[model samples]
Target: MATRTQILIPIGIAAIIIGAAGLISIPKDAKLEQTKFPMGIVKIDGVTLQVQIADTRPLQTRGLMFQEKMPYDQGMLFVFDGEAIRSMWMLNMQFALDVIWFDANGNVVYIQKDAQPCKSAIETATCTFTNGNNAKYVLEVTSGFVDMYDITENSKLEIISI
Candidate 1:
């Protein structure tokens, strides 16, 4: 017959080995690479920006989630099929952002400035979602981008290339 201690000792060691292996396999920061998405060029209020186009549902869902930070001259542009009440959240975001919604004609319909990130589990579960006013496109940039370039509801977005 086997002793309880003999069986327990091996189980404990196996647990520790499994735990360490799990930790080693996990990435410290799985930052989203820009090259994974198609690139676009857009201009808003005379400020030109290089943007990542999130045109598909999968790409839109993963927008800026794990990125540590973004340059002031760069942004993510969400393209939809038609104008509607689009919504966005900051779940898993690493930094704050300024979100802008545009109509089909490229006219700004709504803007959320300095939208904060949701870090903890509770915060992520309760993260607030911002909605647009019948918008066909959405743009997300570094927190201060809107104020820095004086982007307003009257501002228009020009897609130089996509």
Candidate 2:
């Protein structure tokens, strides 16, 4: 009942629509691999930091794990699809960090300053820190970032780009 041209055109349009939607829908907990993910930037009151984005499964799971050293003002930002009571740990971590959580509106909701690193996954699991609040983003910066910037709860965040 339909010509080849007519039938193929609708199929092509449907495919494009579905593809675009897929690209727009990244889950909050989805931890994508780092190699394919792009870098982004975050700004605190007057300080800007170069940030690595971890939006998919593998990247989130391996976030800053076993890393050697993070230069000043450099960090990793984890983006989840939705906000929840998120928890983090220092598993296989090489150094301490200040784990900061941001709400959907980019306000600092919780912070775990001076989070100590653990030698093994088993040990780190027992030392998990949770915000007890909903957070769509989590940033891991050098151990003293919080104190250096004087960042605190309800501090505003600026996400430059992703």
* Winning candidate number (lDDT): 1
Q: Write the per-residue lDDT of candidate 2 for residues 45-109, one digit (tens) a residue.
A: 76798898988766776677657889868889999999998888676578999999999998989
lDDT for each residue of candidate 1 in 95-152, tens digit (9 for 90 to 100) = 9999999999999989899989876433542355557379999999999999888999
RMSD to truth, every model: 10.2, 15.2
TM-score of 2: 0.75
Give TM-scores for every candidate, taking all chains together and pairing residue i with residue i: 0.76, 0.75
Clashes of each: 0, 9
Worst 10 residues of 1 by lDDT: 22-31
